[model samples]
Target: MTGGRSPRRAVAAADRTRQPTEVRRRLIVEAAVPLIAERGSSSVGVRDVAGAAGVSVGTVTYHFGSVQEILSEAMVLQIERYYAALSETADRATSAAGALRLLVDALFTEDTDRHWRMWFEYWNAGEHHLDPAFAGGQDRRYESWHRQIRALAERGVADGEFTCADLDGFTTRFAALADGLALQRLRQAPPLTTQDARRHLHRFIETELGPGPHGVGLGPAE
Candidate 1:
């Protein structure tokens, strides 16, 4: 006769033991993202995230130093996911102009509205609270966008698809235009709809690049 733990119990214990530390950290951050996005980082705490993740407070602190760190990491994770989606859209296009069109269209979708709301909260926190943890978050986000825009512009110029006179100036102007339009779109009274935003951006591209292959609007992807 033998006495041992049941097979199901043993398998359950093995599964628990196999969960990696990195996976646990990611789980915690994933749990925290919605909370921070919906309620703002200022309103979320370690206990809330721990409860959401079904992990103990000590586990959260073990992976992330403090509440501020968790919130900041959550913001970074959201932006990283956005970048991945943008990159995927760009990858599907055959030309730089097509890539730009796809990227702009992706920007105005309903799914990204939550991301914009979270980013707005981040900006507000950085501006009003003078919080050191959030100090450069907004700048970094803009910089990432700028880099992508600049790369796309350069590619277009190299391929002879675009006739931008000043690459740097054109990139900066387009980025600013998108940001301003995004803000307007996010307003409660939203002066511009997603279609309007796309039209405005496409028009600007046409004007800058002149009416050619690069200037042709493909319209939003289905």
Candidate 2:
């Protein structure tokens, strides 16, 4: 063997050493998401995130000031992913009512259980730890969610698919109902099923929004 590294190997080494700081920071955040999901934010540490991200503890600290910061960033990333997917799926619906139906279906399904778990964990961490960043992020995220609901409701009203005059009131109540039902489903204290949550949401929609222009009733939940 030669005494020097090959050209390709040397380029690869250079690339690793020259990796962009922001990209490396994002990698650490991405890796920390699942860990936070699996083990709450209070339990995760810089070393654990470093191991998960396959980087040194110093590397993680170089990007974030503390484990709390890393977890906060990870929570923000997860929330973005969650809302992005929901928006994408809702966009595929042809009508406002259809979009609302699709959102309820997507939100209460077994597929979103992990996402709900992470969200609840993040909320708890923010409240118990008194993290201003986390609290502000949570408020911003919920406001976005409420805006999404308001937009859909406005579209429905404009299209003559719904007859609700109090859009703001409806949006607030709808969001609160969904959050309460989701918490019940997550805790299983009352043994709420996905189907139960979906049906409850749909019923609320029918009651508040008038079941669209076709008088569509809340049938069996899928």
lDDT of each: 0.74, 0.80
Per-residue accuracy of model 2 over 54-165 as CA lDDT, tens digit each: 6777888888988878888898899899999999988998888888899999898887877887888878877765767668878899999999999988888777776787
Task: Assess candidate 2 and give its lDDT.
Answer: 0.80
**Relative to the unseen true structure, what is the C-alpha lDDT of residue 220 in candidate 1, on a scale of 0 to 100?**
34
Model 2 Cα displacement at 91 (Å)? Answer: 1.4
Q: How many backbone clashes does candidate 2 have?
A: 0
Model 2 regions more than 4 Å off: 1-18, 128-134, 211-222
Clashes of 1: 0
Q: Write the per-residue lDDT of candidate 1 for residues 1-222, one digit (tens) a residue.
A: 112321121123345456799977877788878877767788787877877777777888988877877777787888778878898998898888889888888887777777876777666666664565467767777788888888887777777676667878878899889878878888846577888888888877777764235444333334
RMSD of each: 8.2, 7.3
Candidate maximizing TM-score: 2
TM, every model = 0.78, 0.85
Evaluate residue 139 in candidate 1 and report its C-alpha lDDT on the 0 to 100 scale.
76
Pairs of colliding residues, candidate 2 = none
